[model samples]
Target chain A: MEVKKERSNNICTLYVDGVLDYSTMEPFVEKVRSIEEGIEKVIVDFTDLEFIDSTGIGAIINLVHEANTKQFEVELCGIIDEIKDLFETIGVFQIMEALQEESD
Target chain B: MCSREFINEQPREINKTLEREIKLARNIQMKLLNGKQPYLENGEVLGVSIPARVIGGDYYDFYVLPDGKLRIVIGDVMGKGIPAAMLMILTRGAFRSAAESTHGPGETLTAMNNAMYNDLRTLGSFVTVFCADWDPKNNTLTYANAGHNIPLTVTSEEDIAEFPKTKGVMIGGLPDQEYSEESLELDDRGFVLFYTDGIVEAQNKDGEMYRMERLCDVLLKSYQSNVKDIKESIVQSLNIFTEGVPQRDDITMVLLKSR
Candidate 1:
């Protein structure tokens, strides 16, 4: 997968393209880890993402966990219906909301 | 010269030991996962798991309750290989202990989450599980989901439907999750297939997935067969579709058919 980073003020947006799965997750993890300090919000755009496996899902969960620890806002946007259904089935939204609440 | 030779030989010996240990671990996992399938009074149940590596994180078990109900569970732990396998054992232990005392599938999941939540969260892992109780006397299946895919039900030759929606947070996503249960009354010839995502997510040489459409079609054609035959047909179809491409995740499924 490819990640394109764009920054505006204190918000950082990551545009992810291609498949995010076991074989292609390292770069994504690295990108998430490399998010610069002082950013108030992080946005992940999934408009171009084609597929994601359980490992990919786990990586996103870890990112959410990081958000809780690091004290930043995370927004996931442009999720297609298929991926939305998958995220819902796996309770990704619930986890995100719960962690967000904890941080608050 | 003697010291140099000893160092080289020591590395080889350590490699051999590690390989042997991994093999032993694999054997233990297989034994626990493939233990005896419970005999149903008027139905047949079968479960199969094929790990992508030497050991996998996928798990399934059958427990015959005191009231003659058969409890079934299938789960996929996050990640893969040895670490995931270790947590899978933990999950199995929790499930086994919980199934003995819990009244229904929902309660069993709640118990399992309570048992395993702290450890799983500390380790930064989660598991998606689907638990169900099949009552042969009444021909009914009651099930609950912990962030797992819903099983498919084949009621007629031409129609298949997902089990009614039931939702809960995945184990380790949060503490003290209480899963809700849904029930389905099965026809005498009905078939229910519970599976992990690996079956549908399997990719071919062209990087194309073996999508649900194909799976549903195969199930429709094979639903009339016995549980074992139906499972084989699905496996055969997957084999043909993948065309020798390596599987990315562990494939697991449990089949229940009213006899």
Candidate 2:
């Protein structure tokens, strides 16, 4: 998975791309945790991510858990429907805010 | 479930018609196991689920053995879908007969595994099985896990006991595999719960697992309640847990209570 970081004003943005599976969980979480302390709300863009397996799903879980414990608001935006469905099934959308529109 | 019906009309192509019916049957297939077994009274519930799918990959049968043993069997076929289901059916027959004749949980699984392995391997299929009996009289249970989930026992003592450890290859993976028995002596009024990996692997909305820790918490919480109630509570908790996250895996669990 590829994560791009952008900061403007008070918002920190992450643009994620590629497969997010078991092998990619550590890097994925570390990247988010690394910058979490400096940000108010972390917005992750999943528009470019293709597939996610079990471990990848676990990483996402870790992200939310960390975000909650650390008291930082996290939102996922620009996600494709396939990945979105995966997110929906796990019920992550209920707890985490979704960025409703595509950012193309 | 949005169901479309073509009522009062025979299908055009029988082959296509049969296929459609099978798919529909699968979608609507649900188990309503409402009866007392072993320690349970008139309204007690004891059940086990082994999917013929990724989560339900086995032809599961829960019935009374001729000698009055509370028999439960869960066996997964080598692969997924219809072919595996067919193989599960075959594997199931051998199990029931052996369970009846030999009357040993370990033997039943071993025999079925051996009998079906070559044929299953030929078809590129394998089966993982767990079979057992609940003895309410002594407040005890005996089981054999053949490459299946370790069944957990919630005793009246409330000391949670997992099915004992045994080293055995998954069915269909090896031609000659030996399985050993694991026994649990229950406190009065206890039950055994078994399930597929699907439950632990399920995810919540945050992409976190509705993992083993969470599932164990539920089991511990609901041990004293009725099986159906426990199942309902679990499903509800899972639904709420994911909030709006979609199900990535099938969910199945079987609870057998010993009074």
Candidate 3:
């Protein structure tokens, strides 16, 4: 799994690529978790994530909860339709924004 | 004049016909679970085991011997579809192959795990399996649960008792992990069910689940262990639960009953 970070102005963006499964999720989780201290807004881009197992889904859910605790609004951008459906089915959309495109 | 030639031709034709028939039978047998009944052994009942494609990714096929012994298997592949089916068939072949020598539940799981780990993981896949040797003659069901969903044994009161996961990893992940072994009683007329997460994770229009708790509730309601009724109730509830909802995932389950 690959996680790339970009910061512009106040918004912090993360690009997640590759499979987010138990084996690969370890490092992915650490990268997302590390940004909790500084970012005011966390935008995750899933345009690159190929597959995600339950554990990976759990990590996303954990990130959502973490963002809530940290009071940072998290928005997901550039999600492919298939992975979007996965998050929707698991009720992740209810907690975070599932963006098809980014206007900014 | 034609007798010698006609007689010689009959044997070859018969051999070819036999080969064709065997091939046909194999094709029919492969579809043993072609979206039909006799396949749905368990109705809306408690603790159902829906064995998918007798040779698919999920396999749990068991029967009793004339001397009154029960055998059970629950295996999941590291991949889905045809490749999983091939591995399942290989396991079946190995079962019949080492049936005499492969008697213990623990040993069977270990043997299967070792053979597949290197090759299956090579394809970025691994299987979590639970193979059991249920000796009805002694009312004992010994099994080893791989990295699969924990099997739940329910009672007439809608209470659930989870069986332990013994010596098993995701079957092919680590070479040195120890697989634990455990056993349980089958004295009563209750049923033990096995299934893939597909069944429980299946969602309806509202995103509600045909979860384990709800499934157990259905089984407890019938209080009758007839495989047909129980299977029907579960499927019926599933249909109701997922009303107007397309299948989100492949739902597979299997059930075992003792008389």
Candidate 4:
């Protein structure tokens, strides 16, 4: 997977492209966790993301936990329908919702 | 000073030893995962896991609870290869222990998460588990999920598919995770299929995914077959769909059908 970062006024948006499977999860996790310290809000854009599997889903959940621990506001943007259905099916959306509420 | 021949033989010997150890590990994994099938009074439950490698991260198990209910669980640990296989064993231990003390599937998952969450966090990994209890007397199947895919239920009388709803995060995703339980009555000759993501996500040479729609179609066609036959059908369909494309992930499934 390829990650591109855009920042403005303490808000950082990360655009992800390509498939996020087992091989790409490590670097993806590292990149998500490496968001700049000054950022107050984090957004993950999945418009260009083609595919993701269970391990990839786990990495996203891990990112949510990290967002919780680090007290950063996080939002998932431009998720493809299939991946969104997957996240919904496996209840990842619930975790995101719950953690986001906690942060709020 | 070691001779050249001796040095050459050392690497070969180490390769032999490594191959032997991997074979041993594969044997252990097979024995544990392919243990005895559980029989319900009027129902049958069968489970199988096919690793992409000699061993894989996919897991499924059945436990005959003291009260006569069958406790079933299927899980996929993060990643693949040897480390994933090791964690699959760890997941098995946690499931077995939790199934004993926990009252229901939800409780079992909660206990499992409580037991393994810290270790998973430390290792930067996680697992998705779906647990169920089949009560033959009541003809009710109660289940809970920890971020695993929802199993599809196909009835012989109807062509439609049903996905039992569940709500929970993956094991180790949160420190303290609570799972919710849902139950449904099992109809005779109907099939309840629990599977890992591998089957649905299996890709063909054309880069086309097998997809859930195709799986549903296959299940609808095979709903009348015996449990073993249904499993065979799934594997056959997957093989045809992939058509020489190598497997990318471990495939596992447990099919429960009432006679």
Better of 3 and 4 by DockQ: 4
Please give, for residues B65-146, the per-residue lDDT of candidate 3 as tens digits. 3444545666555444455656656655544443345556676666666666676545545565666666655556787765
Error of 1 at B129 (Å): 0.2
Residue B68 lDDT in model 4? 92
Question: In terms of docking quality, how is candidate 4 classified?
Answer: medium
Clashing pairs in 4: none
Model 3 alpha-carbon drift over 4 Å, by segment: A1-104, B1-56, B63-68, B94-99, B176-178
Best by TM-score: 1
TM-score of 2: 0.60
Ranking by lDDT: 1, 4, 2, 3
lDDT, model 2, position A71? 65
- Candidate 3, chain A: TM-score? 0.83
RMSD of each: 3.0, 14.7, 13.5, 3.2
Clashes of each: 0, 26, 23, 0
Query: What TM-score, to 2 decimal places, does chain A of model 2 have?
Result: 0.78
Interface Cα RMSD per model, in Å?
1.0, 13.8, 10.9, 1.7
Residue-level lDDT of model 2, residues B1-259, one tens digit each, is 2124345435675556767767764553333222233444422545544342432344566666665567677654533455545665677677766776766787777777777777764654455577777665665567776666676777643467677665454555444556677777764566667776567766776667787677777777887887877777777777778775766544557777654
| Residues B8-31 of candidate 1: C-alpha lDDT, one tens digit per residue | 777778688678889999999999
- Deviation in angstroms for B79 in model 2? 4.2
List the candidates' TM-scores in order: 0.94, 0.60, 0.59, 0.92
The residue pairs that clash in candidate 1, if any, are none
